[model samples]
Target: MSPARVGRVAVLAAALGALAGAGAGWWVDPGGDGTRPALPATAAAGRPSSFAGADASWRGASPGLDAAHAAPSDLAARRTGAPRGAVGTPELQALLRAPPSALRASLKTAMRHRDQGGWLYARALARQCVLLEMTTLHEGTAGLAPVDLNQPLAQRVSAWREQLAAGCAQLQPEELREAMNVPAAASGTSATPGTLDGADPLIQLMDRPAPPGSAAARERLAAILNRADPLMLSELGPALLQREGEAFVFDGRRLAGEDERRALEAATMLLPCALGLACDERDERVWGPCVMTGDCRHATREEAVLAATDADAGLDAGPAAPDRRAAVRAWVERLREAVLARDVDRFLRPPG
Candidate 1:
């Protein structure tokens, strides 16, 4: 393999490792309890993992997932029984054109036009959003009508969505206060740190139940988006749209002033590319000879990318970088507007 190929394979391996278990225990205690269960210790490494592609024969879907394979938000194109083909590059291009700020709104608006049952995952997942304090809207303790399967499927899906939406919308402000440790007034604050300039398509195709034969959607999606403008596609996906409804707005509570805009520009500069960290894969997975020893901690792929980007820019690695916090705030607010209002142009900005 050429040096570039070798490096790509190594970063792919490191990223795969991070996705598998690096963040498993990295979660916050959502309940604010002294009582949440502790994350299990990292398991002992088992058989050494290799990059050899598996046989296509072992690639079949699990029982219920065997139905259609369109991405969860493809409302008009029900996956009912379509054999999963490669996700269209154009579809990904459209996605990459979306910036982090508009991610949730873009998704929610798309959901409005969706065919029934297209986002089945949301039914079970909706209430959990509140417990996690993901709601910007209210959900109340009200009775929802029981479902009747004999009802037309659209009726059933619409009713379910309405119930979920109302529940999210009906929560008292106090509930948000009780749920999130952060102040209820600051709704735009992010729970996840380091994601603003972290990975692109943070999840890989293999990271999720991607259609059996598609390339990693994030990489393909990032490429098509940045091809013209060189920076798009930074938010998480339709899953957030399904559950949060209007509450899923990224963050539009306040606009950045001139100073804040300058801070945002600094933050945006720190991004590995407007394209995302996914484009910068290289052998540099942290400092001081750790990848060979396997004893390093604090060296997940996100850490590696941050370190590599800093090194490439002749920056240092100690405290957080300039505008790190501000960047996240700006990014979230950007998503808020796109998700809430019906402005498609917000989703189409050229990378700065």
Candidate 2:
């Protein structure tokens, strides 16, 4: 077989192996034979129940579960007068700009201290490290010819599986979102091609005057959000990333897991509405005014990213809703093409 053929086999084997890993992670009810409770998120996390630095007082980082303790909103989190100081700092900018492999050593460092825990940034960075590790599995396993057919594939597969299982053990869905910077909600889906070129929310937001002035606005928004929901925008990331995966399948590759598929549609809506990003004409269908897009709502509705009022009132997920899955699917296809084309500049911009 050619090297490409061998690599394809390795990737397939890795996916199947992950299924086994997933199954093993589920817990059997203590008394109920085959049933389990719906609320066992921690039990379902399938790794250590305790989050790293979960107990520590972290500084200058975006709020984690730990942030709920005092004030992630507290200015004291910073020493110098930086708004977020170290927390908001993109520690991985250098690595993200580098190849995917460069993340491995840093991931190892995060994983080692993941439990011992130190900085809130380290804990937050570890969450991204876990995700990066998952990507590397795909990148590393995507190609390779096993020199000896006699070698048990488990040797190659088990180690990586174990690593991912441990790293993501007790990983919450929200942590996944902030790491990717994918929106949990957006302001509108009616974004036209012309508007998206300049109207991408992040781009638009960046163009505004610097904070303290503008930052003061966000702080005010944060206070309103704390009253409305103290945990602001954490869960939004995972929902967006998962649903976006369905929209982003490429070269026959796709994302899976029931937890991932659940709430995909609602989360998809949030992208254009909450994040102020462009909607590909396709996603234009998957979300909109609640009356029209109600059918597109993910059935399970268990893992909500942002609350309904928050998504609608704050982010504006309600607007022209979908006619069919074809909408989001089409948008995803366009995104896949862009990524394959290495259109980094166009990632947040609406696809053609």
Candidate 3:
């Protein structure tokens, strides 16, 4: 076989292998039987989860569970300023315990690619911690009324900011880039046009912004995205570096290999939600009468960079509301159905 043919075979084999593993994993849902949930009657609607009442402090950058006691008074306090002799506080002690220490170590590893953006790293760390927090909160409040989403979000945000300031203050661009070994120059090289630039009927309808003066109406947009199932990027490995060719279909045309397809899908599935979350959280916590665009908000220079990429890529620029999370959740159920029914077509489409 030619090198291209070999490459194609390798890609197909890898995808099939991965699909098998994923299939097995889903089949053995340790938590519950692998029954997928039903889709809702109507897709959730509206602007990015309305910042008017959304919790700003719940963003991914807020300090992990440690921020509560690390700086009891001000979530922005430097690590050096933490209560020097009061390390005995239960929360502080808990933060020092093996679990949080393990979490910290895990963070260092996860942040190995820090140069991508400190804010990005910070946001990721905060999100993981919040998920942990939310999980714990749910367990603790089993059978309780609705969570005090506002308070937890505020506390999480405060803690996240403090932790980010303390942990990331010394991270200069060059040092971060060197640590991650991602060439700062290479970020400029990817040449694929974004999703909306193509001819997909669904995407085309999603290309434009929501109608004007719909800020309040669009508030739930972010939450809608947030509630979506997260895309597992590992599925696209074999296709990453392959050349775009007639065999590869993306947007509407045959592009290249799996890499671009994966990128396009991610932009379609995740970018918009990330942007909506960032915007909604920022509006709820930082600004007043904020518009949808980043320019109308108070993001730091770093966050501004992230926001711009999402907006410019048009990944996050879909119809103002699609219950993206719900879509993903429903997709998960469909996957379960496919696996049970042995439906090959349901499992083989280009992701998103």
Candidate 4:
């Protein structure tokens, strides 16, 4: 194989490794003091693990729209399905009723005790509210066709966010710094860091103005493509690519222009996979819809997507098929090659 092909293969291997087990233990709690039980060694190694110790029954239950309409206190009391010592009805009520400053303090306290189920759930809910607000803001500003916010899922997300934000209009600015344990002096005089800038160095690189198609820019692009998590790359890739007339511009610079067809193809293929990974990983962003809709029956986002589009559609709750897995691997490799070569035309092209 050529050197370029070899590198692409290496990138695919790394991505697969990441998907398999590199960060699989996020849900694991070795101490097992009832906050969460430790997964078995096999489970931690990327095998299908039973949710025996966790109150995961909540995932399969559909609390329905009426549940959404119920008072927060009533829902909290009825949904005692969280693990022991998870946030209780009283605490939930307090959080819902707390003033903005008090809520911020409560959330900060929750951050400290995230190992406990109740605190973790509270933090997760708060994060989801922020994510929904961000999504709404992005949709409004991106100059793209906005999604129907009136859709059931969209409505649920909006309602959940509005309910949460009633007490806490926004998260405290220092939350991320405190969570990441960054020194106060390092962040300088800014009370709030730029969201993307603070989160990842790669994002900072993307935000900077670089000469179009320069060697340094290509190198930076290559590093981002190769090093990014598959989920991150899949989501961020399209945002970086903008269609300008017949050509596409990446990061606001006109690189080699690609037609719209290929860009759409790439998005169509990669986005669902990213969504699946997000839901499978139980990401906090998905928690809002899951909790609000109370239709967490789908274990994977792919399943959720299927059910949304076609109510009768069903997916096996087992591992993905070998061919589907192979397609994802090939897609990632293609993306890596496109980035390394600085060729937008090949970015989402399927491997020959």
Candidate 5:
């Protein structure tokens, strides 16, 4: 087979393998047997759980019950001014950015440190990785290819699965059991009745500020956006841009100023990719012609967006085809720059 054909075959195989693994309950229930009680419909809809109103102090509390008494690690001692549980350290960043081949070792290193929020951060990262892989598999099968032979992708899926299982094992039983007991009302989903599910841990954290208008809430939003991985961005960006009575809101307050407006526009353009990767796998806005034509040229969401024509409509509407594609490409570039710069402020600033 030609190299392109080989690539397509690999993707198809990976998708099948991933789907099979998911069916076997490896991906869906990595922590145990697939017998855990389903979260209430309200909770699944992103309503704040009954637990959302819990004391604000606990949200930022030391990770472990005895964490306060534990001596700081040499790494923690050296990083002055860093937040107690911050995950942005250079070492952790390196681990987060590590390739799949190196992921297991990186996860092991990340999971070893319980102080300074290392383990929590690691769990979040692992969970994100698993979700992203599942998204990739769905996209691959739905639009790109149709077969199960890719060893590398299968290995990656396996690695993330194992890491997630390891992370879950470290969680206290109560934490594991009660994490999703959040009530729909507390989720804010009860009030708005939107499709965005805030059940994901990172998304929950981003949306769970005690008093939504507080300075601490703003700081938390900025911190998470600044440090967010691509999957996190795909999930959180759209949630931040959610509309309420003629204005966009992040954490419930209307977006303020030109900077926030710019962020909203970027998030709007990001929706198709977000839908593909983090929201709805079956959304036609994400699938494009590949779903029908089976040509599968656009393997990635960026490619799909840039390849989109006026006929594709939706967000790609208004401007001429080339202009719309250019706009998306520009936003994609701006997003890349902001992520690389590691600054939410840069993300809000108008692109030069």
Candidate 6:
């Protein structure tokens, strides 16, 4: 086949395989957590052992998962019906977009290309077998209630590590060494330190189910999102509409100032409007539940203000304290006006 055809074939196969697994509730977790307690340790391998060791082994499993015939047959014979709403669909793709900040972007990218043969495998397996471990965690949490939107992002990171270790266990030392690129002197060192930049997407896809007839293609479909910054979801989704049901009123109209403008501009840089702002001691931090989502929101506002002031001051000592404080006070007033008016646009517009 032509190169283009070959590439299309790979994509098609990967999609089918992934879809099939989603339907069957099968995932590959590279972490050695044994997501499938009933299945044999080497079931994912699905073939004879190529090698074995504490940290590495190779099961000559067929890369072609044959989801069309195999997946449905196995799913039917299992006897246990799927959970209340267990129909498999492409859900992971929805999560590919970036979240709150650059850190989340970095993680999304890193997870996309993780080695499925390692820790990524375990995570996938666990998700596939249990189907609800992570899902439940997400749905169980309060706020941002999108079935599994509340899932702790930190837990996903932990699961990624687990998947990596488990997949690594099935490889031989030489294979592990080669996969991790560990030199003789650096036997125990991790080769993935900086390589995470390239591995994120692979990990993301692998963690999801492999589409039918595309196991081999899915395994080989390795495309790196080389861009330094991936797409941010906050920028793509619906705009944040204020729910306060009030408006800012100045002399004759709504009260608004440069501070409100700057604050709105700053809002774009933040996560869901659901994480509003709160007064933390003397500083304004992201709004949480207690002190503000007290846990997640930090001195983000203070930090931003400091950064803006420092940038404005340049090398100078900055204007007198009273002058700076006056500016902040004015900003506070504008913010109040903007919030009351629910002028999300004016709020986000940068102050001159």
Best by TM-score: 5
- Over 1-352, each residue of candidate 6 has an lDDT whose tens digit, in order, gives 6454344334333334333423222222223343211111111111101111101111211111112212112112332211111111112211211121111222223233233212222223222212222232233355432212233422332343233233322333332222222132222123422234334333333223324224432232221111101111122111222211233322223324544433333322222111121111111121111111113212233333333433434422455533553454444344334433444344222223
lDDT of 4 by residue, 1-352 (tens): 6454344334334333322321223223345432321221111100011212222433442222223323333233333322232222323323322333234554555444332223322433344334333343344443233334645554544454454454344444345223323233222223332332223333233343435445554555554454333333332435444444545453334444232233333333344233112233233223323333233343443333222222211223334333333443344344434543546444322223
Residue 98 in model 6: lDDT: 12
Off by over 4 Å in 4: 1-126, 129-173, 176-200, 210-217, 230-235, 240-281, 294-298, 304-333, 336-345, 348-352
**TM-score quality measure for candidate 5:** 0.38
* lDDT of candidate 1 over 1-352, digit per residue (tens): 6454344334333333333332222222223442221121211110001102212321232111122222334433333321122122223323222222232332442324322211111211222223222111112313212334353432323333333344334333333222222121222123232232221222221123323113433333333333222112221221222112222211332223543433333222222222222111110122111212222332223333333333333444545554443353344344333432434333332223
Error of 1 at 264 (Å): 8.3
* Candidates, ranked, lDDT: 5, 4, 3, 1, 2, 6
Of the two candidates 2 and 6, the one with more favorable TM-score, higher being better, is 2
Error of 5 at 122 (Å): 3.9
Error in Å for residue 215 of model 5: 4.6
**Candidate 5 overall lDDT versus native:** 0.36
TM-score of each candidate? 0.20, 0.21, 0.26, 0.33, 0.38, 0.20
Those runs of model 5 whose alpha carbons end farther than 4 Å from true positions after fitting are 1-90, 96-102, 113-145, 148-207, 210-217, 225-234, 246-296, 305-319, 332-352
Report RMSD (Å) for each prediction in the order shown: 23.6, 21.4, 22.3, 19.2, 16.0, 23.3
Candidate 6 ranges with C-alpha deviation above 4 Å:
1-300, 315-317, 343-352
lDDT of each: 0.27, 0.26, 0.28, 0.35, 0.36, 0.26
How close to the true structure is residue 56 of candidate 1, measured as C-alpha lDDT? 31
Reference-based lDDT, residue 338, model 1: 40
What's model 6's overall lDDT?
0.26
Q: Which has the better lDDT: candidate 1, or candidate 6? A: 1
lDDT of 2 by residue, 235-338 (tens): 22222121243453222334453322432333333322221111111111111111121222321111122222223233334442222222433433343233
Model 4: weakest 10-residue lDDT segment is 40-49
Candidates arranged by TM-score, highest first: 5, 4, 3, 2, 1, 6
Candidate 3, overall lDDT?
0.28
Error of 1 at 52 (Å): 39
